[model samples]
Target: MTIHQFYQPPLHWQQFEEFAVQLLAEVYDVPTAQQYGRSGQAQHGVDVYGRSRKHGLIAMQCKRLSDRDANNQPYPGGPITREFFFAEAQAIEDFPHAVSIWILVTTARRDTRVQGYAEELNEQWEKNGIDRTATVWSWDDCVSHLNSYPDLRKRYYRDVIQVNSVDDLDQMVLETISMAFNRTAFELPLHIETPDEFLQALQDTQRAVRTGELLDRKSRHVIRKSIGGWRQIHNRDWQAALGKIDKDLRALRAGVEHGLKDGSIRRTSNYLDFADRRKADELEELRSGCVRDLSAVLIEAGLPPI
Candidate 1:
């Protein structure tokens, strides 16, 4: 019964810059994003030089309203205004390297006024023939990204828990497995590469079939559903079959984790021969069978096969 906490990151501006850099790296492939010059240095109005797949080169300035300032003093920074945004955008021209996007990231709550100003600024830049777009990201944007990317959540929020007590386990089995495999880490042709991410994903599907509670990186909540576990499945045979699948799924995750810890499983390599991918390969095979079995269970229960 863990209580969900608000997305309040009590961090200093410098730590926020590092957090932004790491988060950017996670979202972008082979990210070239990094924190720019240190404080009190001539940084050309850029606190972070981030990259984006869609926008190409991204220039970011993190305007964090730190809970405390340097020297451990109480320092809640001032609000971010459109005037400040304009001043920052005006200074980007001094940055030596060209960027495709200019983003002003703030820990401040979102302001529609500033957002609209950024959009208008983009148009002005376009009309002026400038080769960049202006954007604004408030604390809410970071929180949303945290929810969308599990690895980010795990790194930032160590106490995150995923409880799914309301959703139907049968439908959940179909959805959870689909969600797991469809994830960027798992998909692109499923194979275990990231052990931490893999284990985090496995918990959801495992919980769905087993009819128990587990942490989901995407969510933080405790909900009660009509049917909490597999015990609610009316067909005894179907229930028993689901139980069997859960047993194998649990073992599959355990074996992979243990293998990873023992160095028998190497990251980013699925070679079954020398890498000792026995457990991972088993999980792959079981995943395929599990989907087929899931469809069978749904169909047998007089429901449409997913």
Candidate 2:
């Protein structure tokens, strides 16, 4: 679902830490808790701490190591140093019963160096009569985890992965209209045969104009102006041509604007499952209706009829 695009920076440190705590809580299925080490500051290096029934004490820190300096000068995010993991290892001293610490970062990629350092530190801790381990979750790991929660991604990163905005719908409508005109001008070869075929072709062209799938208000106004101007210049009966198409175009435009007023295309699961069951049939009707005025207007406008 293009989740990786949301791993970019500009997220506040507190927000990042809060999200990390949520992730850790979900992972451990534990009641999340926090502690203050000395005075009012968080204990050791742990920003969030919790205890799991199965895994005992767990600590986590979220590091949004930005690609910009404190002065806002741009730089690389990292190749986080091994010592960073060592510093996080110090947090285990505060939670003497801690089984593991998770260091989450937005800068590094894999961070195997930090993982290796933690493994070595775990071995040393065993010899010194302490038992603790550390693990670093890099940007890739965080994205992979977050992708599992589609609702959470939608809530927090909706702007990052936008779909079906009004502008997008307008583009779709413009392209569809353009394609219809091209087909009317160049396709259909011989004259439509049989009374049924002739009537069906006219219906299709009219339906295409009337369907109103994605033609928004301002875009419809601009398109109508262009078409009206073209008709005025090239056709003697410009009023007749505009009369046949303008009302449908106006309705289509209004429908598109109303559908996209909220700027979100997300649909309820049940609605998506059952909505527009006859979409294919409706589309076929619209496609057939696209050449309704081709014989009269399009040909006179220097675009030969299909």
Q: What TM-score, over all chains together, does every model reach?
A: 0.47, 0.45
Off by over 4 Å in 2: 1-6, 31-42, 68-79, 96-99, 102-106, 161-306
| lDDT of residue 113 for candidate 1 | 82
lDDT (tens digit, per residue) of candidate 2 on 154-246: 655565456344333333333334444543312442222222332333343333433322222224321221111222222336435544554
Candidate 1 residue runs with Cα over 4 Å from true position:
1-5, 52-54, 66-78, 160-306
Error (Å) of candidate 1 at residue 210 is 42
C-alpha positional error of residue 94 in candidate 1 after TM-score superposition, expressed in Å: 0.4
TM-score of 1: 0.47
Q: Assess candidate 1 and give its lDDT.
A: 0.63
RMSD each, Å: 16.6, 20.1
Minimal lDDT window, size 10, model 2: 221-230
Highest-scoring model, TM-score = 1
